[model samples]
Target: MLMYKVTKENGKTVYTPHFPPPLAALDGKTVELQGYMIPITSGFRHNTFMLSVLPIQQCMFCGQNGIPAMVEVILSDSKKEKMSERPVTIKGKTVLNRKERNRLEIWVTDAVIM
Candidate 1:
């Protein structure tokens, strides 16, 4: 059970999990996550949705590859009828590995296709 706020403000608060927590090991492990869809790179793909791991209020206009360490997951396909501003629950086996001083990115393996 973990949660990261992906909202950004003038003084946005950054989130960090405890030591040796599941935040990094989620890869190859079945886990559930809940957050909003972050379509990066100007939403050109129109099919790719990234999970916002941190609280980011300002939508990124560039440097999509440099998303916050809160964890931005690339989805499998278009599961949502339309992008919802509210948060949603995502369950699947996390995959991929990403780490920084205070950041971690884990891509889920088997998302519910939504």
Candidate 2:
């Protein structure tokens, strides 16, 4: 779902997502993903964070290369793990953002570290 084609629309930048059938099919299903955890909060542990295909050292949401594949992960109420630059595996339900108003294209709800 992160696959996008950038174009100019009405003199503004637009990113159109291209979801393959296989990826689209995964929606609403529990999927396991492995990526680097990017914390949004400043605490030692986090329940909400972003998982990126690229390492935390790299810019996941900025740079000339454009936004990398990332998912806003909302960990389950029972799970709150410490932040780590190393890659982590999470299991959760995949949700695709169909609304253009949303800033991110994918999300992992009810996630838990595996």
Candidate 3:
């Protein structure tokens, strides 16, 4: 439901993710995005995985604009605790500010291993 779509445009890639637009309380702050942890990078992400993102299209590698709202998760702790590659709900503080960036970039904050 919270997935963002990535498409190609004018020889450049376009990354438009639907996220909770900036709010007064969330300004200059970090919030949590809960979804199925995916590894965009192959060798780096395998069994041990988790991905922090505003949407699927918010990839730092392929995204034409450096939207700072996307973050990759490398689950270092017990991978067993992290589950579901499909789609799961997670909550974390918002670390990336769209207004702060001149362009798009991925932004992420570490999740609490509870």
lDDT of each: 0.54, 0.83, 0.45
What are the models' TM-scores?
Answer: 0.49, 0.78, 0.35
Better of 2 and 3 by lDDT: 2
Give the range where candidate 1 is weakest over 10 consecutive residues by summed lDDT: 96-105
Superposed Cα deviation of residue 59, candidate 2 (Å): 2.8
Candidate whose lDDT is highest: 2
Mark the regions of model 1 whose C-alpha exceeds 4 Å error after superposition.
1-24, 41-47, 53-69, 74-81, 98-104
Candidate 1 residue-wise lDDT, 1-114, digit = tens: 455545456897655433346555654777778876666546434344666744346445344545554344545554433455777677777754433433244565446634
State the TM-score for model 1. Answer: 0.49
**lDDT, model 2:** 0.83
- Which stretches of candidate 3 lie above 4 Å from their native place? 1-30, 44-83, 97-106
Cα-based lDDT at residue 65, candidate 2: 58
Ranking by lDDT: 2, 1, 3
Model 3 CA lDDT for position 75: 36
Mind giving the per-residue lDDT tens digits that candidate 2 earns over 59-104?
Answer: 6444535556788899998578899888999999999887665556
lDDT of 3 by residue, 1-114 (tens): 224557788988866644555443453455555654555445532433435443445545556556434344433343434343455544444344333323323344344433
Comparing 1 and 3 on TM-score, the stronger one: 1
Please name the candidate that would achieve the greatest TM-score relative to the true structure.
2
Error of 1 at 58 (Å): 4.4
RMSD of 1: 9.0
